[model samples]
Target: MDAYTQPRGKPHVHLVVGGGGLKVTDQAGAEKFGDLPWKTDLDWIRERSEVTVSRLAELFGVTRKAFYGWVEGANPRKGGSQVRIAALRAVLATLPSDLHRTAFFGLVDVNFTGDASFREVFQGPVDDASYQDRLNAKLAEINPEIESTVKRLHRASPSSRAFESEYPSA
Candidate 1:
């Protein structure tokens, strides 16, 4: 089974258990038994565990800002099947005892993994001066406020005045 840990304020682990059905045993009793019904759907959360911030936020009905808050795991994740609950518990066992919101999901390059760029490859090594220059320009071009201010001055709020003047001249 493979496991992964998310990178955030607190960090959480995603565990992949294999080769056996969900098992449960009371701490007082030594005997093991099959998982109870009603926790089956949690398997989906396990299968698709270890997602990125935006992805997790969308999948788990959490706002992006809410995900950023450093609080106890607030997402109402009740168990649908004991198997999934067991799986979740097993995964939780590997994580820090403190399960905060930020710790619940971390950066895993989770959503965008493929070659997102339209071009075939980067023009140069990431650290090179040319690459840095291109990266800076690209970032500026993609920034919403910067782009709006530059190409579409019309989109600027009527109340917004130029920095140099009380009112910006067209």
Candidate 2:
């Protein structure tokens, strides 16, 4: 069977040849590629948002196992998936880290952009830059005080925020 088509939980090898016949393999089941950042990004979303792996998979129209691989440091097969993940992270970054999961869902469910929910807008291919700009502008228009307040709270000390922040460099 082709390695990539194997079922979940089964060990599979991926070979990448380049650089004068150089070969890369996933022998021990570790997805060693450009996957470190994927793991980190997924971790960040799980830590700060209501977006569970299942929800993410559904939103991106992929299987839950796919997200598991991504969280385990596996690079997505498509560049579009990577772009969507990055875009979601960027959108979430605008909100306060202390926002509760329920609040996060509620906030994004609002149809601020048009007829579709933010979830729908993010689920498909679109102009990310334009979407972000419109989303931010609409949010600010709805309530500048709330937007500014959330930003301030998101930057506050860990004690005041939902998640801990790293210490500054010495």
Candidate 3:
């Protein structure tokens, strides 16, 4: 396992298993919230979440203009909004790329109890490690099939073309 803190003075620690995947952990805890890695690819997030920029901005509690600026290369202010974006990205990264936007948003908007959805619950200042742990637990309870499918996808070749090229006779 190759473990190291994120770059640009970000406080999160990442463990990269050799020839495998990355695992992000909050090594510095809540004290490091100010230094959490908020810089991420906005385009990727937009594509993955499949939501309009306005809705995305609303989700992070920011204005459309501000979100657009961030998408266009401006750095978002370091604070709760950025933390929420980070949290959303963390959750999205766990899901499959091909999942329908409706299903994805449905998961996000499903009521946790009577009054709170995953979106409402994961907002504001959050402890990264605890949040990820809880998210994993919730996902497991909500849809075990998604987990199994993710595992299967990870084990299989991502490119159908690669498979076809390799087995031309089939």
Model 3, TM vs. native: 0.52
Poorly placed runs, candidate 3 (over 4 Å) = 1-39, 144-170
Q: Tens-digit lDDT track for model 1 on 118-144?
A: 111122233433543443343333343
Stretches of model 2 off by over 4 angstroms after superposition: 1-35, 110-114, 126-131, 134-170
Q: List the residue pairs that clash in candidate 2.
A: none
Arranged by lDDT, best first: 2, 3, 1
| Estimated TM-score for each candidate | 0.19, 0.54, 0.52
* lDDT against true structure, model 3: 0.59
Looking at candidate 1, the ten consecutive residues that score lowest on lDDT are: 29-38
Worst 10 residues of 3 by lDDT: 14-23
Query: Largest lDDT belongs to which candidate?
Result: 2
Clashing pairs in 3: none
- Decoy 1 TM-score against native: 0.19
Candidate 3, position 5, lDDT: 45
Between candidates 2 and 3, the TM-score winner = 2
Each prediction's whole-model lDDT (CA):
0.34, 0.61, 0.59
Output the number of the TM-score-best candidate.
2
